[model samples]
Target: MPVHRVRFASVRSQRDPSAPAPSVDAREAAEERLLEALAEAAGADEPVTALAAILEDADPAELPLTGAGRTRAQWEILATLGARSLAAARVLEPHLDALSILAQADVPAPSGLLGVYASESGGVTLTATRLTKHDDGSDTWRLDGTKPWCSLAADCTSAVVTARRQDDGRPQAFLVDLRHPGVDVGEPAWPALGLRAVTTGPVAFDAVPAVEVGGPEWYLQRPGFAWGGIGVAACWFGGAVHAARTLRAQLHRRQARADEGRGTGPDQIGQAAYGRVDRLLRAAAVVLGAAADAVDAGELDHACGMVEADRVRGTVAQVCTEVLQTVGEATGPGPLTQDAGHAQMVADLQVYLRQHHGDRDDARLGAALLEDEHTGAEAWW
Candidate 1:
């Protein structure tokens, strides 16, 4: 799908041709389409096939490009998908992020699903070596070693991967074809509680052919790097939204029963818990919205991307933590034990939230402030 065209989910009335599309409408529409496709493809023999079907149905242009004026629409869709299915959102968000990344680099996305894998770990790294180009002016390279945390490696046909260049020792982004003969997707570390449907594990590449995207250090230096991180926070926030909704549902059940004179209404404690959840969730949403607007306005055009992303990600992570804690306390062990969906959501959110570096990220932010004499706390204030 062209990034230029958009097709909303139509949760409300169809968009008026003269009017701009709203973020909430796009979110609901995409969620409806995704939920239906997931329901229809639920019984597929393989998870990858099911995932492919759902993704193939979701138009790449469903939400406008981030910073294309409808940036909030992009995040709203991400949050709703996270609310519906983090496993599914886990796969889809990167696919969408890849589209924006490719657009930023003036590269046309290849047909089929794409993944954005940038993570690396100790003792396991993917290295890129330039290969002799064909007479057709192709810029190809070979990749070797293992790239960790490659979610849906088997499902994606292609990916925008970041690998350390052997010549320069600097990381560069590449538009890689996962179908290359030298590529090998390893077995997932299964039985994991969160994002179980998404096959996230190590991928071993042996001389895998690839096409370089932007030059060395281009991927991390790009503004999309921070925008992409904020997208993940959008998923985290959405997961919290669902968790709060689950608690709200339990409260409603209690209140309904009490209205019939059969049980007591929501007590002060439960009501207080809901209030706290609501406050945190809305605050996070506001931060996300402001961040979206800033991106669209090109406010982070310089090098503030890292600082901007850390603040939003850290705030959202803290809120998610508090919401999970309060909900668990208010609802007790019933949802954890009795409700499978709620249980899975809570577990998935917990594991996904770990992507946020917690204190390490906080320290990074504080250090940024302290190291730069020009950067005072009042700048943030």
Candidate 2:
């Protein structure tokens, strides 16, 4: 199989051995250019294309977004972020501006992908923690837990984990080395419906020693940490778009064929079915765009308000399935022989859309709402 790779534009090298450390002005200038490029790439009109550019052109040391301007690097970050959260934004903003610099510097790959879980008596929470206390007055945390469904697990060298300090009840975040004895990458077993390319697998950690980044308070104060849900939505949106486009074109071609054929009657039912699928896809796109904007605006509640992210997360699968069904019906169940791309796209999307499931549904949103009620927060609009 041809693995997807990150590609980037080349720039001149500026590194000189024995040269003094770069001044603040130089660093800022470099960072600014990278961020601008990233922003341009990760926009509404061209996210998939933007992702391709970011993966191909990032310089980690210069941008701190990708571990390198490599697909593996960007994949690791995307996996670690799990596709949602303000933390992802925090990680995204700085590097989006200066990706080219990192692409040129040959930055190292990020640590690993199983560092986002918090070991709790209740369950495995996707919250950041602080467990280790290191020297220099800096706290080093330990992450000792298992994480299921990590993306690009084969490429990460380390992970940013969620754990707690033995001395305090507070949660903490740790950046742990994956090569350590405790970190064990597992087989890719996410046989769900979608994103098979993402390597959604399990990771086991036997008490991995870790370095704290921002302390417990800082890490906990970050976003909802449900970045995967967002990625689910993104993938879903992509699939939906693909399905809609494919079906629309198929309909047009079919309509033209029917008009030119010796058929006794018109395919009214087929036309209606195609029309409905197209409408759903159009609506999904609008909803998806709004949700993405809300997320970028640091408005989790608002984003969730548009329709729980989980619902939006499942939209791609639902929409794609509907489209496939419609296409199948329109073509009279001839296995959709002519629209192979549409079929493959639907297949690929189905593999990725399984991220939305039982516990991951809007029901969780309701539960979260109930939990908020205890804190005097309104549970509903």
Cα RMSD of all models vs. native, in order, equals: 5.5, 12.2
lDDT tens digits by residue: candidate 1, 1-381: 111111222222356788975566656566556555653453355645776766765666663576667677778767866776677668768988888888888787787778998997757888999978779665779898889889888889899998999988899988888998888898888787887878788888898888888888988888888899998998888788878988999999999999999899899999999999988887888788778878887886535767778898999999999999999999999999999888988989999999999999989888876765653322476
- What value does the lDDT take at residue 31 in candidate 2? 50
> What TM-score do all the candidates reach, one by one?
0.87, 0.57
Clash count, predicted structure 1: 1
Cα lDDT, model 2, residue 8: 16
Question: Which numbered prediction scores highest in lDDT against the true structure?
Answer: 1
TM match of model 2 to true structure: 0.57
CA error at residue 100 for candidate 1, angstroms: 1.2
Model 2, 1-381: lDDT tens digits are 111111111122345768997775775566545544544444335343344446445444554332222322332233223222112222342233223222322323352122233334335433334454558676545566666654444444455555555556566656567688877888877554333334546667776666665555544443333333444354444444545455466567766776888443436786687679768766665555554444445555433432345555656456656766666666553434565545555555555555467456767655656666453333445
